[model samples]
Target: MVMCKDVVENIIGYIDAELDDKTLEELEKHLDECPECQVFVRTYRKMLELTGKLRERTFVTPEIRERLKQLLKSKLKPN
Candidate 1:
């Protein structure tokens, strides 16, 4: 079983499906025994779901994208 601290630290990676099988299994086991971690996981998952829904909408206009691109290019250029 994994410790609560480790589980909390890696919870974001787990939610993103970025963990290997061994790590994911360990996290699952920790969640099984820790109610607080379980609640944390549920809340995190809900937040991700909400964010994903919001991301489906187009909030950035094309003019904003061009300005952002120009800003990034200026920032990336060597002095």
Candidate 2:
């Protein structure tokens, strides 16, 4: 079984489906008995949900992409 601390750190990757099978299994086993990890997982999932909603709301406009590109280019330019 993985330690609670490691599971907490990997919670985001797990929720994002970025974890390998072994890591996922460890996290799952830990979450099974650990309420704190379960809550962390729930909160992480809710954050992802909110982020998706925010992205849908903000990125539907072409202006945001253009503005982001402009900002990046400005930041990347030599002073």
Candidate 3:
């Protein structure tokens, strides 16, 4: 069974549609029943949309993109 923690951990992949079939199915099942998780997903997507709008108005150079990628990679690494 997919748990709340699993939802959080796989959120990015889920939003990006990168999860495997089984995991994706499990996550969807959980989301269907979990109101809190449904809110979280909506909020997360809204945040992404707001940030994306801001990004659209700003100039993000290749250097900035690479730096952001490196920063995200570092932050996403398991301790």
How would the candidate models be sorted by lDDT, starting from the highest? 3, 1, 2
Global fold similarity of model 3 (TM-score): 0.69
On TM-score, who's better, 1 or 3?
Answer: 3
Q: Model 1, residue 23: displacement in angstroms?
A: 1.4
Q: What are the per-residue Cα lDDT tens digits for candidate 2 across 29-71?
A: 8889999888877887888788888755644468888899999
Better of 2 and 3 by TM-score: 3
- Evaluate all candidate structures by whole-model CA lDDT and list the values in order: 0.88, 0.83, 0.93
**Candidate with the larger lDDT of 1 and 2:** 1
- Locate the minimum summed-lDDT window of 10 residues in model 2: 52-61
Deviation in angstroms for 33 in model 1? 0.8
Of the candidates shown, which would achieve the greatest lDDT relative to the real structure?
3
Q: Candidate 1 — which residues are off by over 4 angstroms? A: 55-79
Assess every candidate by TM-score. 0.58, 0.58, 0.69
| Angstrom error at residue 13, model 2 | 2.3
Candidate 1 structure lDDT: 0.88
Best by TM-score: 3
